[model samples]
Target: MVKRNIISVLDMKDDMPQLVELAEKLKKERGNHGEPLRGKTLAMIFEKPSTRTKISFDVAMSELGGHPLYLSARDMQLDHGETVEDTARVMSRFVHGIMYRAFDYKMMDRLGDSATVPVISGLDNLEHPCQALADMLTIKEHLGSFKGKKLVYLGDGNNVCNSLLYACAIMGVDMIACCPAVRMPNAEIMLGAARIADQNGSKILASHEPLEACVDADILYTDTWVSMGDSTSEEVAVKIFKKYQINQELLDIAKPDCIVMHCLPCHRGQEITDDVIEGPHSVVFDEAENRLHAQKAILLTLLK
Candidate 1:
C-alpha cells in the first residue's frame, strides 16, 4: 500500500527524516526479521556493476522477511533485445518491487512507468538513492546530528556527489564539492538542492580550491576519479584534478576530529592517500556497514 522512491535527489526533503528515524530503531533492534514482507518478492536488476548496492540490497531483503530475486541484465531476455518496458511489465506481474543499478536514469524511470509495482534506483549516472540513504545513516550515527556540520567532498562530481548534495541539504549539513568545473554535479541537481537547503537551513557550495572547502569541514569524502563507462582522458583528468586529492595536508585543515570517507574500491594514491584513509579518524567501514540497515528501512517503507 506504500508508494515508491526511485531517484536520490528529488524533493525528498521531508521523507528522509522519517526514514532515518525508522532505520535507527531497526538497527538497534537487530535480529528481529519482521514479517512485513513475508509474502512479497523484490527483483533486483544490475545493468551496471556494483558491490555495495548489490549485496546490501540482497541482504536487506532477506533480513526483512522478503524473498529477493537477484538477477543481472545479462541473465534475462533483455540480453536478446527485449524492451526494458516490456521486461518491467512482466517482472511487475511476479514481484512486489524492483531495484535497478543502471547506466541511465531513464531506464529506472521506464521500469517505473511500465511496472505496476514500485521500482528502486539502486544506482545510475545521475543518482544513487540507496547509497545516499546509507551515507545519511552513517553521518547521523557518528556526529549525533548533521545540523551545522560541514562536509567537504574532494573528487569527481559524479552520481555520489549529486545525491549527497540533496541529502546534506535536507539534513541541515553544509557541503563543499571541490572538483574541476567539467566534473561538477549536474546543474539541475544543484538548483533543486538549493531549494532543499533553503528549507532545511543548510547549504551547497562548489570551489576549485580544495583547501578552501576542506578548511573547517567535519567530514571529508571522495569517490573514484574515473567513473564506469568512462575510459578516456586519463592524462587530462590527472592534470585537471591533481590539486583536489585528499592528502594529509588537506585533512589537517579540516576540523581536528574530522572523519574521512570514500565509497570504495578506491584508488589509494589517486583520490586519497594511504595515511588519511587508514588513519584513526576514517569512518569508511561504518558507512559500509550502515548500507544494510538503511536499505532495510527502504524495503520496509516500500514493501511492508
Candidate 2:
C-alpha cells in the first residue's frame, strides 16, 4: 500500500471537503469516539516550539487509541549531524506515522520523501496544512457554508496565511491577503491558489489597504507579525504592520456577523487588538479547538 504525506494544503485539495465533513463528525463524537487507531503509534518531531500544534496532535492521537511519542530536535541525533532522511527512515520503522514541525521547509520535504509511513506536517516555514484544515472546519461550523464568504487575512502572510490561501480556494471561499508588500505570501503559492480558486469559482486576492480588504468580509484573520526563526526585529515589524491590525475600525467595515481568527500565541497589541480578539466577533478559541478534530481526521485518513 502507498503512504500519504500532507506537505502542503494543495496536496489535500481533492480530499478537503470530505476531510472537513469527517472532522465535523469527529468533533461531534468527542468523548464517545471509538478507537480507530488502536495499537498504532505516531512519532512527533519538533524543530520549533509549539502550543496548539503540539497539544492538538498529542490529544488527537491519544483519543484515537494511539501512542504519541514527542521528539525534540535538540534531543535527536539530527542535532549531531544525522540527516533528516536518516531520521525519517529510522522512525518509519518504529511508527505508524510521523508528524513533523520543522523550521525549514526543505528539511520537511526531505523527511516526507524518506518516511515510508504516512507523514503529516504539524507545521513548517512554508505551510501549516493541519491548521488550514482546522480553519476550514471552524468556518464551516460558524457560517454553515463556504460559498460567497469573504475572508480577509491581515498582517504578515506567513505559513498560516500561505496554507489558508489554498484551503480557502479549495473550499470555494474567496480570500484576500491584506499585508505590506514586503510581507506578502509566497508568489508561487498565491498563483497556485489562484488557479485552484478559479476552478472553484472563488477568487484569491491581495491588498495593501486593510480597510478596503475588510469591507463586507465574512471573516477577519491575523497572525503574529514576528514568527519564530524570523530575523525581523519586532520594532521594525510593528512599524510596517501596525496599520494592518485587526481592530474595531476594520471590524466595523466588515459584515456585522463577521468572525475574527488568529492562529494564536497572539501579540495582543500588534497584528490584532485586545478588544477585538476578546470581543463577540472572535471565534479564535473555537478555531483552536477544531485543531484536534481536524487532525483526528487527518490521522484516520493517513494512518488507518
Candidate 3:
C-alpha cells in the first residue's frame, strides 16, 4: 500500500490503478450512502486561492459525511509566526485528514512529516497529484485505457505537467511535453518519469517543437502560461508561450480523435484558444468534474 501522505504522484504510485477503479465505481454509484467518513473531520488549508480545488474537496468530504474546515492562511496563526510543524501537530489532533493548497512544496512536506493524519496535496508548486488522477480517469472514461495512448502537453511545464508525466508513465502512456526548453518541467521529475516509463513500457519526451510532440497524439493537454507565483513577467511568458498555444492548426496535427484538455482556470486565447477549448474535441469539463469523484476516492481511501 502507498503511504497516506500524498505529497507527490510517487505517493500514490503503487495504488494508481486501484484508486482510479475506486473513482470509477464511486462516480457510477454516486458514492457510499452509508457515509464512510461519518463524524470525521478534514482540515483544509489554502495558502493559494483556488476554485476547483477548494470546491471539490469540500463537497467530497461533505457527501461522505465528513466535516471540512476551510482555513485561509492569512487567518491562521501560522502566518503570525507559527511553524508548519506546529500547525500540523495542532491540526492533527482535531482532523482525520489534512489537505493543503500551497505555494511552497517544502512547507507541505514539513506538514506531512509532522501530521499523524493523512495529508493530501490539493496543489503545490511542484505537483498536483489529485488533478493527475482525475485527468487519467477522464482519459480512461473517454478512450478506455492509458495503454498505448500518447499525451502531448502544450505550454509551460508546471505542477500539472509534472504529475501528469508521472501518472502517464506509470500507466504505460507515452507522455510528451511541448514547450520551450526554458519553461520545461523539473529535470528530476522528468528523469524520474523516464525511469518509471522504462519499467512500464512507456515513453516520456520533453521537446521544444510543438508539432513534433503533438504528431499523432491521442491527448493534447495544456495549462496556464503564467503559473501562480511564476517569476516570469506576463509579457515574457506570453511572448515565449504564444507559439505553443493549442489552436485548431495544432489540434489538426494530432490524431482526429485526440481530446483537448486543460486543468482549468484557463486563460482563454492564451495557452489555449476559446474556439479550441469550447470545441467538440475538448474534454476539459469532464476533467473538472472528475476532480470531485477522483478526490472522493482519495478521501475515502485515505480516511475511511
Q: Which candidate achieves the best lDDT against the true structure?
A: 2
Query: Which stretches of model 2 miss by more than 4 angstroms?
Result: none
Ranking by TM-score: 2, 3, 1
Model 1's TM-score against the true structure = 0.95
Per-residue lDDT of candidate 3, residues 40-121 (tens digit):
9999999999999999999999999889999999999873689888888988888899999999899889999998899999
Q: What's the TM for model 3?
A: 0.97
In candidate 2, position 128 carries an lDDT of 94
Alpha-carbon TM-score of each model against the true structure: 0.95, 0.99, 0.97
Residues 170-285, candidate 2, lDDT per residue (tens digit)? 99999999989999999999999999999999999999999789999999999999999999999999999999999999999999999999989899988888999999999999
Candidate 1: segments with Cα more than 4 A from true spot: none
By lDDT, the candidates rank as 2, 3, 1
lDDT agreement of model 1 with the native: 0.84
RMSD of each: 1.5, 0.8, 1.4
